[model samples]
Target chain A: MSVLPLVALVGNPNAGKSALFNALTGARQKLGNYPGVTVERKAGRLALADGRPVELVDLPGTYSLNAASPDEQVTRDVVMGRQAGERRPDALVIVVDASNLDNHLRFALELIALGLPTIVALNMVDLATRDGLELDAAVLARELGVPVIATVAVRKRGLDHLREELGGLLDSAAPEAKTLPPERDFDAVRGEARRIARAAVVRETPSRRLTAAVDRVALHPVFGLLLLLGLLFVMFQAVYAWSEAPIAMIEGLAEAAATAARDALPDGMLRSFLVDGVINGVGSVVVFLPQILILFFFILMLEATGYMVRAAFLMDGIMAKVGLSGRAFIPLLSSFACAIPGIMATRTIADPKDRLTTILIAPLMTCSARLPVYAVIIGAFIPARDVLPGVGLQGFVLFCLYVAGIIGAMLVALILRMTVTKGASGGFLMEMPKYQWPRPQDILLGLWQRAVIFLKRAGTIIFTSTVILWVLLSYPKPPEGSAVSQVDYSIAGRIAGGLNVILEPIGFNRDISLALIPAMAAREVAVSALATVYSIDAGDDEALLERSLGDRLKDQWPLPTALAFLAWFIFAPQCISTIAVTRRETNGWKWPMFMLGYLFVLAYVAAGLTFWTATALGLS
Target chain B: MRLTELPLRQPAFVDLIDWSVLSPSEGQRLREFGLCEGASVEALHHGGLWGKGPIACKVGRMTIAMRRNHAAAVTVRTGPDAAP
Candidate 1:
């Protein structure tokens, strides 16, 4: 019953549907590829040529109305007017890749058969011409009995003509189902589509097919994998190397702001709230923005070039051996950067069980959030001197922590596939899209959106949690001038006192317990929480005050506690944002709760084991 | 012979398929990839770090990546090009 004349842009996967939608309607919602990179429906407002505003939706790409995956199901449902929460679209713009006409035409034909007001958008006509093929839009329009608009969505060609056609169609009366073609099987429609495509093409010539030439090496057994590996190495290296200056810059600004607030405000809870809770808590997260953006830039760019799919193809064998799908590879790799997007990326996974398994194991990857915890602990305990000639002991242990997460994830995936999420790995089946240089605008747009989301989380989830944590640490102040620490009188401190009883068996002290609770807000928060606790404990002791957080920890914390805590972080679902995203993606409390439950158990056992082993070995 | 057994770059017709053995989604994918009976297919590439892995096949104008297991269920006749 919604009024804005709804127009749904539909097409086969990689048919330039999304690009066209972006061109016609300024982007609104996001998708992952079901959204694999996205599945969510993206809707926007498009003003027709006559200044008539209409609602436009970009549905998930589908091969045909016969939906194969949940993503395709949305397309099918929306188009057929069966999708809940959406009105039947008033008109359909069936987008087809001009170069791959035969395959794309099949889906277009199926949609056209639905008998709604429809037009064919011969998208990517420029690519087709480049590939040495000429498309006759008139012939196509005549044959299909609908307007055929040749569009280069990326370049915004034929968009005005497209909008004109849409305006005219929507201005006219609602078309009845009089044009509904007779029910046909898959082959019948596809064969007819081939005939129509053959008729529409005016010329064809043999050109060097770039995709095939690239695949010769990209899909090669040895070189393709090596290339993929090289690309991944470069991506990780860039994330670490390129992000340092931006992080430091963000940190410096936060410090300056905090200093200004401290100087301007009278010293009290207000100053502490502004300095510690608002500025420092939020600033800690904003600092990681550079890393997140850097990681997403590489993922988005690779995805745009269509190499991401090929990466999955190359990794299928190894991934299959572990009882998971190849599609799981990208998400798992994404987890190393941050588990939030990684879990969101699992929407691309088709199988219910396969997606569930990927979600469950995604957090087990050593996200950058855990890097601070590891860096702090390792700097305090592990020696920087080389264990081997060139391999520093600290770096080696860091490497081992990453390796441990991977091995743990693999074992857990194997076990889950056999138990809770038991199912045959949904065999990886995907269309290898044609390679094209990603437009700079698209890459920038994607990165901008990602940065916005990351910042938004800092504002909402991190903001609320930081305030609550600050409140917990502040209230119930110490009795007047007793030599007692303020934290010892606080509610959070008492909670940690109780938690220490449970964490004690694994070598954790009261301060470690205090830090672990806030660390659940984010893994990196553990470092600051530890620093805060130590500084509070320092309390007028000038020697303790001058020492760095790491140095203080080095003196008081045993090697076993440090080792056990590192082991705990490797498995713990420490980041609230990851759990929140898990809840959103899975659409219920069931999965996120399951994720938290299992991860807590794993963290406990891992810490206990590491504690017992290190203690017994007399490392203490 | 099964589609996996076809020699690389050799155009073949999908002669028969055991739909029962393949999952619903797998069959749907094959259909979407245009690997139906009598469709001309050429095994373009073998993916993964090993020989036994997913197969990249040219089905019509599109290239589809599928696992060896799914490819094994598809029977094909490799000879002169034939329309299904």
Candidate 2:
């Protein structure tokens, strides 16, 4: 079997490089971290028109070979074949936006100077033509001494021509390696790019006026800020409102499956494991999938429309005041979905101090993993009555929890910036791509990718952990004559009994302490852990196991305890993956350890305060 | 006048950049973003609640937000007769 030729897709940010990669790769893709950094390494399989298979690597977007941020460094390293454990790419596919040829041609020239077999993918030609730009691909190809193929990545137009050209290149001998000239004067490069662009592109009409009109309002100080906040408010509300029916259906399905398993399997350890452990435990966490998807839907739409960059511009002042650049906004906002990606996104922050500070506070930004815990608690305690004519009381509590997390993260960022990571904030110079209506296909693909990742985590890690937790709570057969339940005699119960000494002050009971141990792996697992623990404690009461976990939680735990648990989750460094990512990103245990220590202290103090205050208010 | 002091939406031509006020890399980055001498610039918006924060400027086709101190390093000629 001949080794497949490696093709790298490279371009500047917002060049539709990802759209092209997705169009080419479809479902045949793999995503992982780069050799040492947390920046994602995405590669996919592409079968050419001539029946030749090629490996396509989607390199991180970069403006130049002069790497400033870690993301750009990864791109440069991969292109130079200097990245560890990565082979040199055989061919380079430079995806350039046709509407903005001059802006993109500079980077294309840099890649061309590397002397690789290169193909220029003139992406978004549809948008370019609509904007009254006439681009001659043949002229561009001749000028750059490379094949130029017009492509509309979103519509999959001209992909066949792109593949055919790539196939022809793959069949030929590898191009001789060449290095860029030692002279790094970008002015010359810019001049050459302009010269080439002038010959290849003709602007029939000015493209900036329409975009400028939109920016007049979208970038307005008062109106833009209000619009951004309104968008965010709608997103949070939609996560609850749009997902309610689907969540209830998922919960019903989980309960029905658990009951069916209970009836099909005879009374034994296998039955208990399948019904009580797997279905009840993992099901509780899986039920929150709809909420996670709805949240990502809004995020993906925002990203697709290019408003995310404008958001960073809007928040730049506040972020700068807190000693961070506007670049930190994207990472922190992404943290609302998950901290691991949020931390990885920080690679775009040029300054080491700013990046590190951003990573430290990322976990406090209300990740989707916390949604299950929050949903269950809010569903149980917070009444269903509307705070206003339209907003439910439960959703309002959830929004408050999210706001609390953001506040906690901002305060921590300020402290870290002022102290350990102290340094002048870096530049906030970033491209604000023109807005376009989000393509349904692109948004669907993004949502699908997020759903797969979440379900995979639920099926594997959550499934395995739940089984292990079941054993810890189910075994060591209580003395046949003993009045105490089997859970009381189990190893997990013993451990929780000991840990309760510390947890008790925070209003965490023995069962809650038991859940906390497994919750360390993933925050959402706490809900499932509690479900399994309570189901086991119910002892032969199958009906209790089938009941809604929220109802069970409300009956078992007091108001103060539930509120304290929510408080702890807001600040707790519960996700082990986040900690692991922190270690990898910082390249040491020092920062991760410090993060864990501070978060632990914060979680404890906050939970204790909440518990005490609620008790004082007679909420208990 | 400093680019920071330029009126919003008024076009200006950059005359000089006080590179000494900024770190070498930062100055290089600013130039990379097309804020070099002879580049046309317009202050698009001022950020923050009091509108005295980072200034969003159009340097060529790119929209960039820079701190006041950073913007202060670049001198821009704002007269109607200033060269394009």
Candidate 3:
């Protein structure tokens, strides 16, 4: 009986290694955490030459063998068997982008010296040909002494050939490749790459047309900036316009379900919990799914089309003004989608100080999940109408909120850069791929996956929290002889009233104060919590809360106070996930605590300023 | 002539140098296109209005923006036009 061999897949970003992993493993793959770390480890079983099962490990993408970030450290550790409980891969598969072999081969050459039995898969051959690149696979195979298979992972072409080559490697008695000599490492390998390219590579025909078109538009200073802004405007409009109907339908369904559940059940705590607590709490929060999906859809499309890489180019000047390099923009952009991945993306920034600075500021970017809370509040209080002909007042307000987040993030980043980690700029290097239309299937799959995740959270965390909130606010039967409401007697209301003392300066009443506790599950949960609390008070409420709030707020809190509350949530650092991820990324609680403390101070100051000014203006 | 003085549409092959040495917001782009010191490339096309768009040049297998400063760095001898 023969033991199955272990194989590792490695490459630079956009080299199609992940696509190849999907093609090879199909349904046999499983994703899991690597020991204690949050970095994902994927393993799959594949049939080798002798009909034996082999395990394939797909490693994270990296530029070179020289490790910088934690993710890159993982790649080096796994390959060299330095990781605890993780074995070294028996063989290596170096995926190369055929269109831009120069840069890809630079990394490949370094990997070739790692002394593993290796094979090369030249991916995106069609792209290479379309762009007039010519790579002689036969010559490359001879030079590298490894089987070079041309593959188009997206089209599923060359799988059979890849499989056959893998079989040959599994069976052959070819000696393992020689490792780099003790004195020589990356610098040596880079030197060898230059020598090899100079000897063998030559441009048969220069690529001119497509690049000319792109350069003319993108390299022009003023025009490029305008195009970038236009693209951003369109993205924001799509987030609102595309997701509107779905949001309305979701809201309608939730309300109708609450009414049905309320009418069917007896007038008791169980019915209230179901109607006002769980259904109202979770449903209102989940309604933001369409908006979040629309936001991510545009982001992923920008990423896939390679324009995002260009935006880094476009943002360098702006970032420099804030004491960050253009490289920081990638992580910042990632934060706008989700801060977890954004923190992880900071690994690409190279410099430890720069990475830390970017991590500290990442959460300040407004994520899509925050949109529902903003939308509900803004729609209720901000007043939607045509500010001018064809200009949406609500849309303008939304834009301002986004701008506020950006400005806040920049301010924090500037402070961090000037005070904590003043240093020299790191070397910035990135590969910009040829521009192409984004793949539709990839976009659909991405959107569907996110939607499913959001719905799952709704079914679990949001649902449980809502039901519990309902129960706490509904119990003790309101002491039938008493004049006060049941909720005023319940645990939730008592807790809120107790907490109101601390929040008094911020002008939060008991109901607003009560909402903050459950909002820890997510920032958006505050809106749903408020909806649940108010729905309980109103008892299967007639008019929407916005209208009621408009009147109630005018009478009680005043406009400045209302604006202050909005500003508090905007900068409060209320997200638990952001805190958790920050801890995990920094490998400590220090940064997360610092983040929370500063954001709270900022929120308090902003709210205080707003409240005082409004009172002074006699708006209350 | 110095590379920067090369007339419009003149084909040139040159080594890419430091991008920051050229201009701000400019280096980010050259880096994006995989053009850095010691990377060999040729500017094969040019001419476009600023803000309207970038002037294009062939680099590797892709067409890329060839800013005036960047064009100045690359020295080339006339060859058969590689323009499509």
Q: Which candidate is the best by lDDT?
A: 2
Model 3 TM-score, 2 decimals: 0.84
- Per-residue CA lDDT of model 3 for A548-584, tens digit only, reads 3334444545567677777776676747888988898
In candidate 2 the C-alpha lDDT for residue A98 amounts to 86
Model 2, span A47-140: residue lDDT tens: 9998778999999887778888788888898888888878889999999888767668988988988888999999988887777788899999
Tell me the tens digit of each residue's lDDT in model 1 across A527-558.
Answer: 66665565445544657645655788889989
DockQ of all candidate complexes: 0.78, 0.52, 0.13
Q: Rank the candidates by lDDT, best first.
A: 2, 1, 3
How much does each candidate deviate at the interface, measured as C-alpha RMSD after superposition? 1.3, 2.2, 7.0
Q: Is candidate 1 or 3 superior in TM-score?
A: 1
Rank the models by TM-score, top first: 2, 1, 3
Best by TM-score: 2
lDDT of 2 at A533: 90
Task: After superposing candidate 1 on the true structure, give the runs of residues whose Cα lies further than 4 Å from its correct spot.
Answer: A1-3, A27-39, A50-52, A177-182, A334-350, A367-401, A423-425, A519-563, A574-594, A608-620, B81-84
Question: How accurate locally is residue A466 in candidate 2, as Cα lDDT from 0 to 100?
Answer: 90
- Residue A344 displacement in candidate 2 (angstroms): 0.9
Q: lDDT by residue for model 2 over B14-44, one digit each (tens)?
A: 9998999887667767766667777789998
Query: Which of 2 and 3 is the better model by DockQ?
Result: 2
Clash pairs (backbone) in predicted model 2:
none
